[model samples]
Target chain A: MDNIAGHKSSLTWAVHISVALLVLLWLLPTLGLLVSSFRTADQIAGSGWWAAPFPQEESLQLRTAGPDEMTQDGDLYVIEGNLLEQNGAGDLDISAWGTSARDVSAYAPGKTAEMRGGETMTLEEDGTYRLTSAEAFEGRGERVFVSATVPPEFTLDNYERILFSDDSREGMAKAFFNTLTVTIPATIIPILIAAFAAYALAWMDFPGRALLVAAVVALLVVPLQLALIPLLRLHLSIGIGKGYMGVWLAHTAFGMPLAVYLLRNYMVGLPKDIIENAKVDGATDFQIFTRIVLPLSFPALASFAIFQFLWTWNDLLVALVFLIDASGQTTVMTRQIVELLGTRGGNWEILATAAFVSISVPLVVFFAMQRYLVRGLLAGSVK
Target chain B: MNPALQGVIIVVLAVAVCVGYFWSSNQILDRVIFPAKGEKAGQNINRANMVRPWLFLFPALLVLGVYLAYPVVETLRLSLTQRVGSGYEFVGFDNYVQMWNEPKFREALLNNMLWLVVVPAASTAFGLLAAQLTDRIGWGAVAKSLIFMPMAISFVGAAVIWKLVYDARPLGQDQIGILNAIYLGLGGDAPQTWLTIPFWNNFFLMAVLVWIQTGFAMVILSAALRGIPEETVEAAIVDGAGPLRVFFQIKVPQIMGTILVVWTTITVIVLKIFDIVYAMTNGQFETQVLANYMYDKLFRANDWGVGSAGAMVIMLLVTPILVWNVYNARKEMR
Candidate 1:
């Protein structure tokens, strides 16, 4: 296609560059969160995540030994300590030092700066400092300003806190399991139910089959929002009120339309001769369906399973209304993340970690079974 | 009982029951009700086959009716009635009137209309650009996958991701958010809070949807582009058409049907969008959409009448696409 008439070589480079920029634009946001999740709170607050891999230059305030720690030796009051050790500035190399905020890096490291009252302070490259005064030290510690190069640091503490800690308020471990509980059943149940219905619509001789298929297609676009109040009312009137069972049932019901639509479309495309041959052998419709159509529709079934798994796993609305009780033990990952977003809005470490935890599973499933997912999308849409 | 154990038990029992029903019903239908060895086996077999389809369809139909179909009518009814204590009172159109009078509901409706127009169009356009460009390049698949990666992230997750992008600090402090960083880098005076600004914030929220959905549009449209026959494009090039002309005139016109399908599908998704707005702004600074507005009425305000009315409005917006899809399906079936 590129070799076709009127295709310019420069335009090819333009296309490549445009696509690169677009992909970068698309990836940067999620990458920011991913990078942030690995950073400490102070590190995240200090600099942007894009600068995480490089050493950062920052101006920090340091204090010398207090007057109480000074001693008079040969008519000179002397104070000594390591500025980095006192400030807990781990792994930072001081390039310059100063006595005032007006010029934070006025003097190089290892240089001596003369102070008022005949005081002299000398700071070294390794953060060791000495202060000498003719008179005895009379006040609190002297403030020293330093500009240091801090090495890039990363930690897994955010994940450990969000996942392994006993702090239930921000932990995603419980919601992770709850989402699995909702997803597995909701995904599996709909497949068998829809498969049978799809087989009937595809193979079996029945009146109103086309109308039923059309109804399923129409039901495809009905917003699940409408189901919230009515279904909640029904669930409350019955024994099941906002628990795993209600969510699974709601998801299964909601998923039935697409499950049936995709599977029916796939099953209808099966060779007619196969069903006819099975019938010639005196096999019942049930036998033909179970033995022939079911095995043949594996791709379609897998596609819908992926679809339903991703949908139910990523869903917040269904789980919010149907599953979670006031006890909140039944909360799923999406809901938990939303809660964290509200309460921990400014805490990027917790928010990024929580968001990543919730998004990781579906991403794994998506990439692994992308073929089936794409197949499902093409079949479900573009009909 | 522990919910996890209960979940396991329910899964096993549900699968067992489904298998058990299908096996026994088929057995009863063939062996007892319509025994092929009997003198009247022919008529009995005919009766059995007719009943078997409904048996297969019963569970799915039951669920679809009780869950999806019933809700539309029930929500409409609930919208008309006022919740009087535990029961409901018939107050026809009062909820709609109340929703009409409310400022928030009007804001939500207008925002939804804006979303309905902007998200689909922008997504489709970007998706088309991605599809056409990617198809011409060697490493296009990787780029396409990266763009499509956002489809897997949940809307709540996306809201968090974009929130960081739009984050703002005070004038003196460093800007961590990319949007603010870029703004300040481009000679802007101060870092702006992207989500809090009125009117424009809606576009910020819609950007998240567009980001997530463009990959979807790209995948479908790419497939459609590949499906387009080679001869038409070749003929267009032979007729002195440039690459751009060949694309817009020849390729796009051919995939118009697919483009429309993608548009309507995304339009349906945008109409029902809740989590992005709910998580990002929660309707603050006039970013309320219908789903979030409905959620506010039902849960926060505890007004069932107005909430149900809001649900009806969403349902009403979806009705045209529903009718269009059903009509197309019926047409294809014939």
Candidate 2:
């Protein structure tokens, strides 16, 4: 209100710098993971993601083509080949060369290292190597150690392997589809059920409405841990064991409290005149709800839909208890990522890519509909 | 049938069932049971109107009761008994006694207390700072969105992101984790295994939550800050209050209720803090929280009695908040 007196340029600069620092602090972990997801496994293992944009100096153990591919030149048994291609890293530059790991990188490119038997070997900066021996070549090619500078490299190969590869254990394609299956119905069913309940609680005068509303509010915080065994037992006894239908039902129940609470709060705030006018026009309560109230409650509905969608998509506990069984046929992305974390703990490439794949959809939804999401959050919390 | 195709069919069938139930029930209420054009049209209409709310409420309450309400009681019962061969044997207080003696349970309880105290305070403090700083600047929205972006990520995904951040490499190798990178850059001798350190690793896991929750606290508190009346702030400034003074002495007291709301909301979430701990450390290295501890007992150890007892501990912890919420709700209704 009065920036005239208190606003200092230094303080403003401090605020700016502080905010930037905080923002970077908050964003760095995710940025690191996102950057790592696109990097090759070797690159990730060799350097941090901060150093990803620069050439990474790595000591690679490479070999030339075996003696079978060698051709004699000038009565010399010769093996000429690109060491990088032979080692499966074709896009790196040989910075230095050596014949032994102890003195790896001792010889510069275009330099020759003397052999014990009056033979010689020279490595070019472009990874071309020539090995000249006086006698016939042996069964195996010479082992060479090359200090190569791998340029900044990024690839969709990580995503491709995680998302589209045929390796059943590594692929996330099934889990992605399974998450969508669990999320859509779970999101849609609850909103529909909650809308009708919300309308009744908001507008219609029924006995025990206040108590019912209080119950919903109280249920909002009940930890789903309580529901796991009992509900699973219920589902099992009712012949709806660990499966899709069971998960959908469990998610719906778990999400109902917030749905009814949020929608009721929003519905209660609507202009009273329009609803009264609609009712006075000889329209039934159903007509009024379907026409006037439902349309008017669009923001609240959208808000809860996003909430429920995000909740169900990211949920693991409910799905673990009610959906997944020993068969492991239907695993959602979050659960799948956890399993990957256990089995593939050291494989950052797979972990990061799988996580980003799981995180991407919600991030898109979050940014696209943040206005509604924020509105829902405020309404849900403020009341 | 293809699972994707099955999903599509289930979605379609679910929507159809819900819509059909609503339409047919309402139609039955109006046309068959209580015809509004009959001789006692007004009485018939009153009867139908009385029943219509239940018609709307039936499915919700039924589902909530079966799926939420009854489970609480059942879980309570399950905690009081042990499962025999094919049936359950009632063994009152034995499970709780078992849980009390288990060192892991005590460890989980203590860690949860630590989490409960630290996460909300840190998140709310940082959120208040962020809200205050970002409220006036030009690029504040951008800054806010970046801070808030973590809210969208799944706990498992965040676990991965942070796991990478806290990743430790050998001293000679390049440190992939930025934390270790920064540590080594700052003249530290060797890289620290951030998550493997016993007592401090709890803070490391809690850092992920505080990171995610700080944005939420910021958004809510920012709104509350905006809703602070301009006149009070102007009067405070006119009376010679500085920026920090005005924020604390004037704006803060007014918005304490919203702050508490955000605090308790985060508290509720922290009480059930399983996913991050489960995904990151799996309660290893003395970082066990109650929810994850419960999951371990129930799922891994195959002991539902002790698991239900653990769940009851969570419920008992939340009972006060639940009662307070219901009371406030009733008061608001009145």
Superposition error at B146 for model 1 (Å): 1.1
Model 1 lDDT per residue over A1-383, tens place: 55667457888999999999999999999999999999988778878889899887777887887888887779898998898998788767889989998988999988999988899999998899899999888767999999888888899999999999877789999988889999999999989999999999988877898889889999999999999999999999998988888998999999999999999999999999989999999887888888999999999999999989988999989988988889988888899888888888889999999999999999999889888988889998886
Please give the fraction of native interface contacts (Cα pairs under 8 Å between A and B) kept by each candidate.
0.82, 0.77
Each prediction's total of clashing residue pairs, residues at least 3 apart in sequence or on different chains, is 0, 0
Model 1, runs deviating above 4 Å: A59-79, A86-88, A95-122, A131-146
Pairs in clash, predicted candidate 2: none
What tens digits encode model 2's per-residue C-alpha lDDT throughout B1-334?
A: 8777877898888789988999999999999999888699999999999999999999999999998899999999999999899899999999999999999999999999999999999999999999999997999998998898898998888999999999999999999999999999999999999998999999999999999999999999999999999999988888888888999999999999999899899999999989999999999999999999999999999999999999999999999889988887888888
The sequence of per-residue lDDT tens digits that candidate 1 reaches over residues B290-316 is 999999999989998999999999999
State the DockQ of every prediction: 0.83, 0.82
Candidate RMSDs in order: 2.6, 1.7
Model 2: per-residue Cα lDDT over A28-47, one tens digit each: 99999999999999899999
